[model samples]
Target: MITLAEAREAYRGYAPTYDLLFGPLLQRARRRAIRAANDRPGQRVLEIGVGTGLSLPYYRPDVRLVGIDVSAEMLAKAEARARRCGLAERCQFQLMSAEAMAFADDSFDLVVALFVASTVQDLGRFGAEIGRVCRPQGRIMLVNHFSTPAGLSARLDRQLSRFAGSLGFEPYFPLDRFLAETGLRVTASAPAGLFGRLRLIEAGKG
Candidate 1:
């Protein structure tokens, strides 16, 4: 039960060194996420929880991108990174909550969340919003860690649950449950990252 305020503060503290720390570790997953999207020129893409804009440089130059994060501190760094990487013209960074986005329905061709499912306070609402904003045939790309069906990873996630409230993520989040609740249809999924701990999921609105 990590409150939004606590999640904000946690990210504020992490903003400064986020790129140096989590950036390298999550880069592989991010790359995988964007490539799987297969975005086209002039398409609009929304990136939820686009921390520090690490994925900013990876998107093709022709696409239009909107990246939103709850933490202003993190968004500032993302803005700077976009400018530094010469992606400023193609990308926009804003401070907005994922669960309640301001955009209208059926507004984007693609939506993405990288390493974000664990951090969202209301995943159901977030999923609904993702579906609402994306066109019927649009894609929802996610690269995240989910509780393994069984084995060591599953056990470890359960053990980590005790610290979830303080850490701002619900460890042991079940994929089957999440998909069912969100009503998102998964068209593709593949193991990713170290020991296949992370997953790359491509889904469409049902």
Candidate 2:
């Protein structure tokens, strides 16, 4: 497994081009996650691995947004994006790891992870940290690509996993198992794309 430092280094040189490569598809996923969140007017939202703040614009004005990312370069991009959107005051950025968040327990009304699970070094630890900071009845929204259940897509996913390690991604996490281990219960799971390919999972603190 790669260390957080290694992942940070890998992303450092890629921050600028990161959005260009992933912006469109990820933006689509982010919109789905936001819809799953069903954010009320004044909710406190915590976003993990919030690279470049691409999802910041989707958040409602009344919702308080706190974003955390491991890469300093990515965080800088996120900061710039926040300023560009004129949401600097409402959006806060912090350099932190998802495996060990600094926030206190039960702090946020909603926590979101967008296309971020695959990058975590320790899925269990990341899930635990997410659970720790989430309020008792709060919601967690995740947008992720997973190993498809059968046939050709599953074969491709297997092939992708081999390359994923080098890129600091896990390819897929066993969604049900991870949720159970994390003390979260799935409230809804909807296909975000064709063939139930990319998924949007909305879970509540258990």
Candidate 3:
């Protein structure tokens, strides 16, 4: 496995081309994630690993948005997007790691993380931190790819994990089990593709 620092450095290089490469798919996923979040107006929202602010446009105008990512370069893109979307006043971006967030307990009503679990070096710690910062009964909306059961696709996914890692992608997670282990109660889950290539998980902190 690659070190977190190495992964961060690799992503810095990809920041420029990241949106161009996955922008469409990512936008679709973000829409799905936001719909699953069921966010109401005036809710406090926190998004982890908010690369390029792809989800910013979907957020309700009345909701206060806070975004954090480990990559400053990525955050810069997100900031620019927020500005372009005329959401600069409603949203705030910060440089922070998912494993150790610097926020008060029970700070947010809704926490979102899209396509982020696979890249985390410590899944357990990341989940725990998410739980820690979220208020009781706070919703957590996630869109991620994970290892599927046995099949040709699974084999291909495993093979691709190698290249993905080299490119700073963590594209597989046991999301259901991870949430359970982290004490999150999953309220709903749906596969984003016919082959279960991506999943949308909606849960609440217990």
Candidate 4:
């Protein structure tokens, strides 16, 4: 498993080229996750692993947004994005961990993580934390590349699994097991991104 410190170091190096490299590739998936949020005015949204704030502009300016990531370098870029998008007033960025957040119970109307589930050290703890912060009936959104039941995609996931540390995320994380272990229930799911390699998931606190 990738430790928090290792993840932080990996992202620190990645922060410089992250947008240029993954921005275009992952933009659609990010947009899908935001759209699935169905945000409304006055709702508080928490974005875990909000690297470089790529999704900041996608969210409505009326909704309050708090973005957290483990890498200070990434958060710095995200803060800059918030400023560039004139969303600094509506969005806040912090250096925080997904596995252990500081927020109180039911503090958020919605919680989102895009392309981040695979990077977390403990999926169960991360999911539980997400559930704890999200109010009952509130929504949780995740956009990620998960291991398919059995197919070429699954084979691809397996092939990439060995290079997780260098890639910054695990490629073969099991979606169903993650949800079941964390007490989260998926309300909706659909293919997202190129070749349907990613999934856009909507869930509620279970």
- Backbone clashes in model 3, listed as residue pairs: 118-170
Candidate that beats the other on TM-score, 3 or 4, i.e. the better one = 4
Q: What digit string (tens of lDDT, one per residue) describes model 3 on residues 1-206?
A: 44578667977988999988878865777787886574577888899989888888887778788999988999999999999988899899999998899999999999999888777777778788888888997888888877766677678766776766576775444555566556767788888753667788887775
lDDT of 1 by residue, 1-206 (tens): 45678778878888888888888888988987897685577879999988889888788878888999999998998889889988889888788988899999999999998888888777778788998999988899998887878988789888988887666567887788678766777899998787777889998875
TM-scores vs. true structure, each candidate: 0.94, 0.91, 0.91, 0.94
For model 4, where is the 10-residue window of minimal lDDT? Answer: 32-41
Q: Candidate 3: where are CA atoms >4 Å away?
A: 180-183
TM-score of 4: 0.94
The TM-score of predicted model 2 comes to 0.91
Residue 88 shift from truth in candidate 1, angstroms: 0.8
Candidate 1 wrongly placed segments (more than 4 Å): none
| Number of the candidate with higher lDDT, 1 or 3 | 1
Q: Judging by lDDT against the true structure, name the best candidate.
A: 4
Scored against the true structure, residue 36 in model 4 reaches a CA lDDT of 58
Error of 1 at 84 (Å): 1.0
Better of 1 and 3 by TM-score: 1
Error of 4 at 149 (Å): 2.9
